[model samples]
Target: MALSKFGFIVTGAGFEPAGKRVVLSSEAFEMIAVGVPAPADALVVARQLASEGVQLLELCGGFGPVWTAKVIEAVGPGVPVGSVGYGPESIDVMHALFKA
Candidate 1:
């Protein structure tokens, strides 16, 4: 089936999912972007988006594999889930950027 609706979840400091969400739409497609303060918060947002008929969901690299799996499970098998990944070359840069 054609992908008409898509959802993307991003993680960062001080982001509130409800207040940070943006939806862009046109006659052919719709895209929803949401920001969460942490990876765990993405689970609820992901499920909510799936329930709202989002055909696919993508998570930011901050979520990693574990949170990606959790989101996939939360949304069940109907909606496809994916996450961004950085290559080895970006490991040090990413670490420096997200270091606590």
Candidate 2:
């Protein structure tokens, strides 16, 4: 059996859940989180995770450019960083639901 080299650090700008564990993809991962409430803190922790062999990093859709940049910088160019975003259709749907 061959398992892919995969790891990630999930951080946030508010509401820390330090040492919390959450299963991501069941067969994929379930990390013991070291949550921090600041992007700067996320950067520091993310760098540590990256050093420990995280080949990829990700952030939630709600994250804006600044947060994304911080994560990317921490993980460095060697690792591919990604962030989820609402596409145009998703945005339209949200607007529809909210009557915006």
Report lDDT (Cα) of residue 82, candidate 2.
Answer: 78
lDDT of 1 at 51: 90
Model 1: CA > 4 A from native = 17-19
Model 2 lDDT on a 0 to 1 scale: 0.60
How close to the true structure is residue 20 of candidate 2, measured as C-alpha lDDT? Answer: 28
**Candidate 2: tens digits of C-alpha lDDT, residues 1-100:** 2323344445554646342234354555434345565555567666766786666666655446888887887778987777767878698776775463
Per-residue accuracy of model 1 over 1-100 as CA lDDT, tens digit each: 7999999999878898553899999999999999999888888899899999999999999888998999999999999999999999999998898778
lDDT of each: 0.91, 0.60
List TM-scores for all candidates, in order: 0.92, 0.60
Location of the lowest summed lDDT over 10 successive residues in candidate 2: 17-26
- Which regions of candidate 2 fall more than 4 Å away from where they truly are? 1-3, 7-14, 17-19, 23-38, 92-100
Q: Pull out the clashing pairs in model 2.
A: none
Number of clashes found in candidate 1: 0
Q: What is the lDDT of residue 18 in candidate 2?
A: 42
